[model samples]
Target: MSTSTSSTTPLLSLRGINKSFGAVHVLKGVDLDVWPGKVTALVGDNGAGKSTLIKGIAGIYSFDSGSYSFEGQQVEVTNPKQANALGIEVVYQDLALCDNLDVVQNLYLGREATSGVILDETTMERKATETLKGLSVRTLKSVRMKVSSLSGGQRQTVAIARAVLWNSKLVILDEPTAALGVAQTEQVLQLVRRLADAGLAVILISHNMNDVIRVADNVAALYLGQMAAQVPSESLSHGQIVELITAGRSGDLGLKAPDKEVVA
Candidate 1:
């Protein structure tokens, strides 16, 4: 399955991916390349296997076939720890913050600083402040503010800031703005664009077409566990994308619509 992937080596590539569970084939011969400094939006309906494919890439599930490559080298990422070490971060909609804990504490949860076994709170807090400032995050009142006091956008910002602080190579966002208002959604989208501008590969999974069209540089649609379409966002119209997602293939893809007679 040749795609729009460039001739230049990709930062991350998945080739010949196949996954199944008790006779249910989830993915078949999937190929995708995520280059640095681009947003690849993955879109699909409910149960279209988008989440499953992500799990496979994130190392939650081992696939029966396919090779996952990073920086032109083939590697097996078998678990979350390996992915994290490789600078791959997945930010789900939940944002995964501790409401009771302050921003700094949440950011450095298990990975805390220590001075002779005692946590170096002062240093960590100071570093956290620097990170937030680097991202130009303004809504955050203080590094010591409890997450429970933060708004939806603030929580999302913290999650992304954590990824940026870790120098994430590939950041996967799952429905980043599903629960946010227009302003908050814009905030997340700007953060996403910033990540790409800084040369990080971003894979965004969203059901909202508007969000996808607005933030994506390229779009990949999954239909019924099959990668139905892979096209550059600029080359496609919204109607064409919708057709590709709802149907197996769109007219622009040169595949005949289901049960439709091919024109002679």
Candidate 2:
């Protein structure tokens, strides 16, 4: 793991964030901080509100109550366009790349440049090449390779490259290495670390403990709709994080222990 210094002020911050759908509360008083130039791993078990929280951040769902701040200013993000306007981009688990398009086409799917009613292919290809090179990507043999011919890791790289092409300040990756092989997983993890090192705030959501410990500077564990703990990765061991995810409390690091019921 490379040691990269984080900014003193968080690029994104949430306080007492709560969300609900009808009567079911999905997120409760969750607090999180994401600093620039560092990776914060969002880890939890199944149905631990990880998806809800990330959706709220991505503006796919609105929080019922809480303070949402970015770059030291309070803001309201209730839609995807608003989130994009604020320089927040999310690369969802599905990747959403087109199998029929090549790398350049996929990278500029919706936001292609044009000049006088004609597409600027040269500009698009040049920008795509620059973006991939800026990220130090070297696995792809050619920028014109079709998506159907690319491997899982290469597809992930294209999705990530698309996210950062718009000068985004923060990037949220959802289960990026879920079905990748060992070597591919390592490649994706290194790409994630590079995003942060390039001065972009990153929120990595994953269920894998080893991946969390390997590249995350901090770990934020969610347990049953509540934030169990958000601490430095080096401060907690693998067992402690597992306990927090499973039990919502690990010694004194998480929620306070429930009071014992009297036997009267």
Candidate 3:
């Protein structure tokens, strides 16, 4: 789970990112860095601003203030299309697969290839097969199988494959293993690791500490609306990560405590 070298610039970097909804502040000067060929797990309790920060990264929501830099260049991503153009993709928790459609159909749902006036079924199927094979996915029996019939892990696999099919560089996953059995969870976690191994910068959003410890190269903990800490996963124990998530600090590794007022 070693990350890219320190001298390598991050694929995505956000500094002093701030966002709000009307009167409520959702993100407060949060900072995050996503390195190529590594998985950075985004961990936080509910209402910790993880979703807001990710949405900002995906261009689903624009940050009110912050620096959005991709590949060391500053840029403005105002919408999802912009994010996609910059090789960023997000696989939300819902999976977003069309159950009635086959695997190839789901993979090329919106951006289907065409031959003259007809759909290029042959090419699409071939590409789908290749993408799955490239990821070392072996559980799927056929790309023609309907998504509704596939197991939970297989469906997740399809979603992940679809994300990378567009040549995405940064892939963000939200609760990918939620509601899955132990075996299925392991399957998904392995796929997640493979993504980073293939030189893609991956952002994994999950509450499961074990999964984070198992696959993440770096752990980014969000507390309330602030970034608690971002450190190498191997450097922190499970309990230390839990403390950062819950209290915004694990000893000196996270946010410092505010000054106490004098009562005298």
- Per-residue lDDT tens digits for candidate 2, residues 120-215, read 999999999999999999999889999999999999999999999999999999999999999999999999999999999999998899999999
Per-candidate alpha-carbon RMSD to the true structure: 3.9, 0.8, 1.3
- TM-score per model over all chains: 0.92, 0.98, 0.98
> What is the Cα root-mean-square deviation between model 1 and the actual structure?
3.9
Clashing pairs in 1: none
Give me the runs in candidate 3 sitting further than 4 Å from their true place. 2-7
What tens digits encode model 1's per-residue C-alpha lDDT throughout 33-117? 7878888998888877889888888889887898999988999988988888888999877788899999999888878989998
**Selected candidate, larger lDDT, 1 vs 3:** 3
All candidates' lDDT scores? Answer: 0.84, 0.94, 0.94
Q: How many residue pairs clash in each candidate at the backbone level?
A: 0, 0, 0
Candidate 1 TM-score to native: 0.92
Error of 2 at 252 (Å): 1.3
Model 1 residue 41 CA deviation (Å) reads: 0.4
Q: In lDDT terms, how accurate is model 1?
A: 0.84
Cα deviation at 59, candidate 1, in Å, is: 0.9
Best by TM-score: 2
What's the alpha carbon RMSD for model 2?
0.8
